[model samples]
Each structure stands twice: as C-alpha cells, then as structure tokens.
Target: MTNSPAGHTPNVVLITGTSSGIGLHAAIAAAQAGHTVVATMRNLEGTRALLDAADAAGVTLDIRRLDVTEAQSVTEVVAGIVGRYGRLDAVVNNAGSGHLGTIENETIDQVRAVMEVNFFGVVGVTRAALPHLRTSHGRLITVTSVGGVIGQPFNEAYCAAKFAVEGFMESLAPVVRSAGVSVTVVEPGAVATSFVANVGFDPTAPAAVGDPYAAGLAAYLARAGSSFASAQTAESAGSVVAALLDGDVPPFRVQTSDAARQFVGVKLADLDGSAVQRLTSGWIA
Candidate 1:
C-alpha cells in the first residue's frame, strides 16, 4: 500500500461500471495513483478495451463482475472484497444508464428502467459498502451528470433518475459523515464517450422518421451534439474522481470541468426558477 500526503495508507478502491467510459478511466486513474483498484462491471465479456487501456497505462486492476442493479450481486462483491483486502477504503458508484425522450413520448416502463440502473444501482452499491466504509472512514463518490442539477430537454427520465440520486446522497451525506464516511457527488457536463450511442436510443436515427416529437427531438439532438463536440474527455473526468479519493477533505459536491461548473451554476444561481424554465421551454418549443 502507498501512503497519502497525510500518511494514511493507500485506499482499497472499488469502482463500478468499469466496462467503459468514465468508470473505465477512473479505474485506470485510481490504480495509477497507487490505490488497490477492484474495478467491476455487470459483465466481463466486453472488457478488452478496458484491459487494453489499463495495460497502456501500466496499471493492473483486480476486475470483478458486480451488477449494481442486483442486490445479491452487490452484497457478494462487497463481502468478497472486504474478505480479501481486509478493508474497503473507498467506493465510486459510476454505473449508470441513460434515457432520451420527453415525458409524453416515453413509456413508464422506460423511465423505470432508467431509474433501476441509475438510482437503485447506486443505492445497492452504497448500502452494501456502508458498513465497511464506516469502519474505514471511507469515501463514497458518485458520477452524476449536470442533468442531475438541471432538467434537460429530451432527458426527462434520465434527469429524474439522476435528481433522485443527488437527493438521496445529499440527505445521506450528513448522516454518513457522523459515522466517518464522506459522501460526494461529482457532476459532469457533456462527456465525449459512447454513452449516447449506448443509451439504446438514437434521436438522429431514421427510426424517428415520422414521430410526432421528431422536429423537437431533432432540434434537441442537434444542440446536444454541438455541446458534445466540445465536451470534456472521459479521462479528464476520471482524474477528478481519482483526486477526490486521494483528498483528505473532499467536498460534498464537485463538477468535473469548468463547463460543467458553469452549467450547474446556472440552476444553482436561479432563486426563482425563471432562468431554468425559460431555457428548458425553448428546447421543446
């Protein structure tokens, strides 16, 4: 184990959703920073990219299968980690799913599916790790999106799930702090990843050929595409999570990039909700 600046022993970090995107990057970054990383995902079949990236970075990770949406999977993984490592110093809940559609267009089942992955998945992992975290004075970090703070057009279901996560963490932060565990929510703006393509919906696809919400959806997709063109890289965002895990006094909330900070700042600065309403209204108008 390595020693932190404060001389604390290196963390035994567990990060979920390591199959790709931010989770993959965070797992690599944490391992490079000297933490014992246990990177997990729902399936290990498509982990070649992650393995290749880690190899290029000269860091090795103990990869495991942990489906955060399943309570038994979460319990078994956490228990196994603790039994082997003797302590779990930190857990980064990076597993998430995305949905893109207005409330009028999406089925309730579709929204619930997003919640199952984004909200309940985080809850399962946190609950399973809580006892160990309390014992080790560990940290709980989650990779939320700017949508968590502001409702974006065509992202009703996705934002709702993220909003629920932010609320749950904000409320649980203080309670867990008393038990020596730090809770933090890291929000990122448009990240350049396969996330949009993997979300199981393509607004720009020809499938939306004659949908009622096509025009509005197309416009929103164009705007989002423009934003993603200049978005932060997954590796950059991952470094933020790594830094938080290494910090002795991490903040309760953080934005991975300046753009993210500015985006979230708008809603935070709106005391009357007028600014957000005006902006969101334009998206679907």
Candidate 2:
C-alpha cells in the first residue's frame, strides 16, 4: 500500500463494474477511506443503485461509464482518469459475467462470452493502466474466485476464465515488481450478490429430456444454493478489497474470509488432484 512513489496511499483509484455488488461497495469504501475513487460501469443506465448507495454512505465518487470488453473504452477511461488526476494510483479489476454450464452442453461462443468479460477484459484494462501505474508505483487488484484455484462442477466456462486470471496475474506480479506496481488477486468464496442469480441457472427447470448431466446438475445446484444461503456479504468483501489498498503491500493472493482461505488452501497444498477431487466430487454426489 505504501509502495507508491506518490504517497503512503493511492491518491486516485479506478474500479470497473460499479453497476452493483462488489464494485459498487468497493468504490464507496475507497472514497470513504479518503481516496479519489472513479466508479465506472459498463452501462450508464444502471447508475441509480450505486448513486443511492453512495448517498447513504456519505461519500462522493467520480462516476463514469466504461465497458472493459472494448479496448478503446478502456484506453480512453484510463487516459481520462490520468488526465483528470494527473496520475492513476490503483485499479480494481471487478467487471465480469457469470456462466453456469459444462462445455459439452454449451457452445464455444458461450464459453468465449465468459472469457471475453472475465479474462480478456481484465487483460485489456490492466494493459491500458500499467504505464500509469508504473509511473505512480501503484497497485493492481483483481477480484477472482475460489473456483479459480479449484474447478467446480457445471462451472466449466466460468472456472476457466477465473483460472486464466489467476495464471495471468501470478505471472505478471514479479515482472512488474521492479516497476513498483504491486499486484494482488482477492479470492472471495460465495459472496451474496446478483452475480449468482444472473448466472441464468434455473434450478427449478428440469434438465433437458434425459440429459446425461441431470442428476449431477441437481446435486450441484443443491449444494450451490445452500452455499449461497450462507454466502459472505458484498459489503464485507468489498471492505477487504478496499483495505488492501492501504496496508503494507498486500500479498500477491488473498482470500476474503477464513472459509475461502481453507477452500483455496486445499489446492495450494495438494500435490496430486485427490484432495480437490474428493472435496468437489462430494458436492455433486
């Protein structure tokens, strides 16, 4: 956090996907913490929720529209922020779409849809902001998922996109260290957000006639539903993300809760696939 050449904290911060959930809360938290937060979302029409939340939180944000999937949009937004503040100190890669389906049951385009927003979208934004971050010796934080470390059933596309982010960022951290841009990926387990509902999984809808994955899907959904029922709150998770912006340079990887830490720890310590396989298989059993 104090690694910045500008000061002990990031002066100007930009976050994507502020339309709702983690992005919305993180923007507010950062602003409340005294950072000039630029809250950006893919759609301008969806600003009411965030605007109202900011009003309630007693913090003001420089709101803007930014679609991470578009290269020109990303470049212009980053440029605009730097133009306004003269430098960008931090970026939170929080814009992503959720998908719920296995590869065979889904088309290639569907999988690519997830990747476009979840993975490539991140790459585009990070690329556009790095030069400025390099200038400020700032921070790069991405909100990945526990699924990123251990794949989950019926989340082939979503897990793949998250896994890609994990790999991309892990490789990028060291290379950017000399430039002084600290990188960290925040992994949150089941945060209570519209993200899950938007995944488009109709648990009540019977699987296609005689679908081979019918039973497994049912089991997975039951487990997922229960997990979501006890999911971490978005405000709780966002606070963690914002707090990372200040401490003694956060670790390259972090979990939002003790449960998330334990979930991800399984993969980190597993020499073979057995431990993860055992745990996840039980979810669909």
Candidate 3:
C-alpha cells in the first residue's frame, strides 16, 4: 500500500504491552503526533488505568487484547487492526519480562519463561503483523535492553533473551528491506519501570542465593535498584520512539539512555578481544 496523507500524518501505529511503561507512553506519544494508535495488551481490562490516562490527555486509542505468546491471539489482533485501519504504519514489539539470576541457581523454567515472553512472543507477534506491515511498507520496532548487546552479571537469562531479540530483528531487517519494511531495535539502559521491582529473581526471588552469595545478591540488588531509579523515564523513551518513527531513514539500533549509549561504546570497543570472558569472568564459574 502506498503512503496516504490522512490529514497529513504518515501512518497508523500498533503497539503491544501498552498497559504500562514505555509501551503505554509510546502509544500516547504517537497518538499525540497525529498517528492513529492501536494500544494492545495481554488483557484490555488491565489497561483501564492507561485508558483513563489517555482520556485525561484527550488522546484516543484503539485498545485491544493481544497476548503475544499466543499465535491465535496475535493473528486475531493484527487482522482486526488491518481490517479496520486499511493499513499499518508501524508495530512495536514491547511486551517483555526481566529476570535476574545465576544460571546454575536458576531453574530451566525460569529461563524459559523469559524467552517465551521476550523472544518467542515477539517473534509470534511480528510474524503475524508482517503481512499488514508489508502492505504499507511499515516499520517494526522492538524495545530491547542494553543487556541484549552486552551481557551482565546475574542477568544470564534476561541477557540471553535480549540477545535473541536483537539477532532476530537484525536478521529480519535485511529480508524486509526489499519490501520497504524497516526494523529498528531500541536498546535502553535501566529505566524507571515497575519491571525491576517485579523482576523474577532466579526462582527464589531475593532469597535465591544461600549465605555468601546471598550477601552479594543483596549488594547487586541495591545497585540494580539504584541504577533503575536514576535511569530515564518512560516519557523519555516515548520521545525516542517518536523520533525514530519520524526519521527519514530508520536506524538498525537506537540507544535511548545516556548510560546505554556509553555502554554501547564500551561494548563496541571490546569487540576484538575476549570481551565476554572479561565481562563475565567474576560472576560465572
């Protein structure tokens, strides 16, 4: 589908996991930018608060239920949007979870849980939405983490999942370019979201490690919490999304927070050596 000027706006946008955090903010920000918004979540009822916030801001959103892990649900939601909107301008794969754990101490299920929601879920949603996006030559954006590029201590599973997301999106970008579809992955540093507070901690919550490691865990938790507290807000992330959407050409990777940008530079600089061993040496056995 060729781009049409609907009141001078470029396209309609559909975002997943819009109940809170960057997903919620991005939906509202895009709507404010005059793009039609489809703000979807696992449960529409859980997004009543978001609906109220949008109402207060006088921005309208087409809220729907979208469980990205379920193929049927993804297909239904994308079909509904395309049927109603005639074209899709962009789709943001923003639904994901965080995990903090040592690999040995963490259960297989714990790691699988993160992958299901963060990697496979995104793959399902993006695949389902590709047809509509192809029709419009739209953009596919995913909100990944800095861990995706650089692994961190005690975040083995989370880092793995983000790495998978980055790889998947990166590989998909070239294939879709011929269809005029663009893919951009946003790598954010710790952000002030309920995610950290709700992060699954190695299947044992805060009490996962026994005695000596438990003390280290506590210290790590303190630093992690502080880092997230001092990190960028959801509004700032939304602004970054808005900027990417408005850009003439989409970037393959967009780092939002200053911390993420710095970390990216450090990570890129270490590409030639044993960076993985250097970063994970102290933590991993």
Candidate 4:
C-alpha cells in the first residue's frame, strides 16, 4: 500500500513487540492515526522506549503484556481487550526475533526456538483474535520480512518461518475475507533497527575452532552490514505499516520500501528480480 492515509474510524488496535523498533513506532503511529492502541510486549520491564515514543508522539496507549508464543497468554490478551473495549478491530502481529545461523551449526532446538517465536507466535495470536476480527469485520496484519520472500544465507530457520507465515496468510486471506476479516502482511527489507543487534552474530569473532562456514559467514556479514548501513529507518517503515490500517481494502501484500519491493519482486517475476538474486550470490562467493 502507498503511504497515503485513508479515512478511517478509530479502532482498538493490539500490537505485539512494542518494546522497540518497528513495533514501538507502529504502536505510536497507529495511536497518532487516532486508533485506540493496546501496545503489548513480552515483558513489561522494557517499556521505556515505547513510553517515550508515545509521549513524544503525544498519544496515549493502553500498555499490556503479551507473549505471542504462549497460547494462554495470546488467548487471554485478546479476550481481555474485547472485554475492555466491547469490541476488537485489529491486531498487528509484530513480535519476532532475528536468528543468524545455518542448520548444521544450529541445533534442532535452536531452530525450533526460532519457529516458536516467528511462526507459531503469529499463529497463536491470529487464531486467538480471529473470532473477534470476524465479528468486527476487522484487520489482521503481520510484520513479515523481505527474507520471507527471498531466502538469505544464515537465516534458514528465520526465513522458513516467515515463508510459512506468508503462505498461511495468503491461503487464509480469501477464506477469512469471506468471514469479514482482512489479512495483510507487511514486508520490509534491511531496516535500521535493533533487530540486527539482537542477532548475536559477530563476524569479527574467531570462528568456533575449525568452523567450516567461517569464511562464508564473514563475507555474508560484510555485505549485510553494507545493506543495513543504507537501510530504511524503523520510523519510516512503521508509518507505512500504519497507513494500511485506514484503507478500505488493504493490499494482499505490501513491501515497506523500494528495496523491499525490488527484493520480493524476484519471486513475483523472472525479470530484473533475477539480477537481484545474483547480487546475493556474491555475498557467499
């Protein structure tokens, strides 16, 4: 969707991962757009940035605690919101993690940890809120990544989960729309955010004793660092996400920037997108 705002009624919006980055800005932007925002995070201990941003934006948000990976927490949060507001209008599944490891190096449990947060976390939240969304004719928006479209090295588990999210939402969109709930996924490319900081990957570190992938890891990290150095800001991407909430009909898919669009354009077509794929090939070369 374009960064154009549409006329919209105030909605009760539930957003996950509001402690920082896209989620923090998104919660604030949605509130600034006049939505009744419930900004939630896994732990309430880190509300500093979110609170500060809300204050700076001059918008009040209902702060709550929600862990998307926990079934009970997801269910209870959605139930509580409906009970408090008398209706539920929208949910933004923005809680996610960054993992930087290939399968052989990362244990099965580690991969499962990634899926639990990125994939099942989304499923849990969406499932819990679907009933209310159906009743309210509301929206379901997820913050997926460009990695969801174009798989990246060292992001196997992360990309797989995102790919599953994209596939699940794509398949559910039409069926859910028939029930009055709209589903949309916002895809972003490299963004200037704490996401990378949280990945725990140190290219400068000595590789584990005789790690076979050390050289490839270093090359990929160098290119990735450059991509992020020129990355779009979290606030810009957040605003694009916020704009979608007001439209009468949200696009089935939205890439938050030109880079994101060009990246995802690879899977959507066989033209210039192929050139983009070849560019990543050099990252591990």
What lDDT does the true structure give each of the candidates? Answer: 0.88, 0.92, 0.81, 0.88
Indicate the residue-level lDDT of 72 in model 4: 89
lDDT of 3 by residue, 80-143 (tens): 8889977778888899887787767768998898899999999998888888777777788899
Best by lDDT: 2
| Candidate 3 backbone overlaps, count | 1
Which candidate number has the best TM-score?
Answer: 2
How many clashing pairs does model 2 include?
A: 1
Predicted candidate 1, C-alpha RMSD: 2.2
Please, what is the TM-score per model?
Answer: 0.94, 0.98, 0.90, 0.94
lDDT of 2 by residue, 117-234 (tens): 9999999999999999999889999999998999999999999999999999999999998888999999999999999999977788767987898899889988988999999999
For TM-score, candidate 3 versus 4, the one ahead is 4
**What tens digits encode model 4's per-residue C-alpha lDDT throughout 182-276?**
88999999999999999867766788888898888888988888999999999999998888788566888999999999878777775556665
What are the clashing pairs of model 3?
A: 1-135
RMSD of 4: 3.0
Off by over 4 Å in 4: 1-9, 271-277
The CA-based lDDT of model 4 is what? 0.88
